[model samples]
Target: MVQELMLTLQALGLPRPVRGTLASQLVREFHGKVSELLPSLPPESMQPLLSSPLDASQWEALESLSQSLTEQYCCRRCLLLKRLDLTTSAFHWGDRAEGQGEAMKAVLFPIRGLLTPESDVSVAHVLAARADLSRLVPATSVAARQGTSCAINKVLMGDVPDRGGRPDALEAAMPAWQSRREDGGRGKAGPQRWGRRKKKKK
Candidate 1:
């Protein structure tokens, strides 16, 4: 059958000038199988130019072809976080809304692949979903603290006073208790009697 296939391939303009070695014969057979698989593809696509003991041009062509394929095959659409429902462990895409067209298309959640540990999703899954690691890397504690400090500094710089400092502008605006404290706790009680002691009841 292989001999017949080879003869057929030769009839279709494939070169077989020499009765080659077993290795060469196997290569030709493999090429023939590939040609059968992709009958409509150009000669360049089916060229095994990068077979072991290759040439410089073949190496260059292989690299260029690989890069071209990579560019063509790269995924165009990416998942962007729109609304995250932590309670339900689900998230919606930017364009999807809760009552939009189909319920399945509106939200997505991690599905357990199988009943095996190997199939469980991990941090790697999250890493893979991140478009840019530099942007996705979490804010450091020090950075968070610095931001908080800046916010506090801005607040301190405003009309609000520090803990121990008195606000002169707020003296009249003080609470009743604070005013009473300043006035020796006077007006809070009823009038005091002067030296009149009541007589003993008969």
Candidate 2:
């Protein structure tokens, strides 16, 4: 089938290109079978990424792609990510978000090839939802603390005292206690007496 196709192309423009056409045909077939990678990560490993403060995945993908593209035939790895069939690279963890970003600008088109229209839309939607959620939720402990904890108009507890003071002796002591004229100046427990003193005639 390929020979006939190559022969036809030769008649028009590829008279000397047998190998290049055959290679192209093989690549097309290969991509069809390989376009199933989806960049799978272990639940344990993915947990940290999910818990991370940053919601952006593009940065992670770009970082990974940056290192991968410096190697030979980088498209293989990228295609694997795009297809979502991460079974190929089981332990191949990376900052894929960053790598993918860098790959988009690479001449090899490695990034674009893996990211299809549907996947792009899905990613954008997820990032948008994340951003929306981020606004609704507090980003830090301090931010969460700043929110009101109660809906009541007034505090149930009385106003907190700014400074501490000792209770007055009159308030703390009983009415039965009597303070002598001299005892008043000296804050000592006055002698307790039930009746007044009687005057003795000389």
Candidate 3:
């Protein structure tokens, strides 16, 4: 089912950015629909879907749903990181006054995602649930790494656990893009001077 969905979506040849946006939209829609339905449904009806003993087909469906959710969570994190890195690169080389404003905006989304509580539970608990499901459904391992990346991003973006009010704490916690910018990649100044220069005339 997952494969079929991916294939159908990919068939449209949507660019990566579009694909990601679509995925995010779908995820948000799914959450919204479930949230709406969950409350209205009686507890008796919910139990079978939530904790009932599943035979074969229902269990498979549950596994598929878990896999889809985890994968989308990871993809969203990656998209956020990618956007942050691009903004950081631009700010690093731009005028400080303008850069500061851009930097503030760039960090907002990831910070919100990191700090906001999901379902009133800690991220560790959420991850533990994913781990339990992974053990039961080995197929989840394929997408598990992406989920791990998202979890790590959350920690890195959040406040330092033991260190408080230290100026260097954030610098130390900076994402991989910081190092790349420092090393003269996209953030580097001046135009490329290589490639075939004017040929020495005979």
Candidate 4:
């Protein structure tokens, strides 16, 4: 069935992106319709239909089902929009900005702490502190080495322990990994090393 779909897509002679978008939309529509239909279908019929390669007639039925589902969705959405228009017709347009601002504030009030800054520290001071700390710290330490190895092991096993005050402590622990060279010097001797490369070229 997938092979047949691929062949049909290739026969269109469309560009790769166009063909890909068309294929994805068709698949999504088909799956959406199928999901709606699945609950009503018997267990006995489902296994055979799912396992077997669909014939031309079955594919046609699926296409028709998808078309019907899309039409129904469009009709429902149109009715909903009509109802919304009728409901909002009496609403005052002049106070929209103030009303919207109040509504947004009310919605965000519960989670304001998550959005707001935790400290009074300025950006410059924080950056200077970070630079000074980097200079004071050794190139490699026992804790850093342990953190690096622990990080790798945790990543493989999918069980990393969180650290206090630092979300990216494991990642930042590997100072040796940050530099291109093991000696902790700048990258290779070339013009490319001194400047940022074009994203497209990279």
Candidate 5:
């Protein structure tokens, strides 16, 4: 079923951005045939998923299957690392900023298939859940490494352990694993460079 879903989605060619389930990235491509698939997707069809037990193995399987499909049909590779290295897995998520004045600091993330249809959770709540994911991300990695930067301008995992202060210090010690980029890449950036160019006074 997973493979079929992957194949069908690939055939439709949706522009899925890089997403992480258990520290793995998805194949984000700029395909033009996404509309056709949307209609085909039956909303209720996903309900059966809730009944099935979702243990660690099940999650692992889902991750593996997605990774395989990403490599096969999407012309992409998949890899996993600790959640801490979110700077890498972060991709284009369409995180649009909301409101004006005092409410400007907070941003809104795109949530289409993420929330369960059974619930009536507010968008803020949904974004909060994602923020929770971000908080844990820092803790899941040990070795300092970069995976994928991101496209939605910035990478916010949505993990806010405390809607208060910067997440705990644990996230920094975690380790991360990810796929190598073409230029042997990294997701995040290094120290800011601020230097003036030489003037050409001819």
Candidate 6:
């Protein structure tokens, strides 16, 4: 298949490098479009379609499918962009209530059913919907912080004055740790003292 593409490109009088590059790009696009269409195709048709070389008619079909998909995506993108413009554009103070209504209709109302506590929708379904929505409208850094447990500013909890005179657990344990070390040192010295006493006895 690649050899055939290279030959076709070579017939166009393209240089070797250009032919190679163009062939690679064309093959990638063909594979990508085929992958997109494969899921929708019947299970029985998949093996034969993949195994055989695509004819002119088959190529035309793939090309048409790709074109239609591209058009649908562009239409969706335009709709989203227009909706975003409506959302962010300034409006009169008197129009705020109207704007909020519009926002609810445009955004919240679509997903209101999913948001209901009694809804039978699975968490995976809700998550998939959220994922699709997230792709359509990219999240901002501020939006990313929503539902996060961490605070924006760090507070020094230990630095606060201890009015109750209660020592921390670690601070209270320090004396015990020090006493153990002192005890170990005295035990070592007792062995030396016993050795000196034995020499005196001798």
Give the TM-scores of the predictions, in the order they appear.
0.17, 0.12, 0.24, 0.23, 0.16, 0.22
Please rank every candidate by lDDT, starting with the best: 3, 4, 6, 1, 2, 5
lDDT of 4 by residue, 1-202 (tens): 5655665446543323453467567767556756776787655443321335668997778667666766676677667656755654445354775567666556545654343222223323322342224335543787676655654455455567855666655364544445445554665655545677678864
Tens-place lDDT digits, model 1, residues 1-202 = 5665576667566655366557677567767866676767644453332235657896677567656654544422111121223423443343554555355443333332211222233323332342232344345667566665554455444476557645664456555553434455555666887997889999
**Each candidate: what lDDT?**
0.49, 0.49, 0.56, 0.54, 0.43, 0.53
**Residue range 27-131, candidate 6, lDDT tens digits:** 666567567767876554432213446689977786676667666766776676567556644442355566575764566446643432222333233323422
In model 3, which range of ten residues has the least summed lDDT? 115-124
Deviation of model 3 at 38, angstroms: 25
- The runs of at least 3 residues in candidate 6 whose Cα sits more than 4 Å from the true structure, single-residue gaps closed, are 1-52, 90-202
| Worst lDDT 10-window in candidate 2 | 41-50
RMSD of each: 22.8, 26.8, 27.2, 34.5, 29.1, 22.7
- Which pairs of residues collide in model 4? none
Best by TM-score: 3
Better of 4 and 6 by TM-score: 4
Local lDDT at 170 for model 2: 31
The CA-based lDDT of model 5 is what?
A: 0.43
Quote the positional error of residue 4 for candidate 4 in Å.
23
Backbone clashes counted, model 2: 30
- Please give, for residues 1-202, the per-residue lDDT of candidate 2 as tens digits: 5655565455434344454457677556445533432244323332322334543586677556644544433455566655654542332345664566444346435644655422222323333343234436654566675675446736488787667465653355456855364544646665898998899999
Positional deviation of residue 3's Cα in model 4 after best superposition, in angstroms: 26
Candidate with the larger lDDT of 2 and 3? 3
Off by over 4 Å in 3: 1-51, 97-202
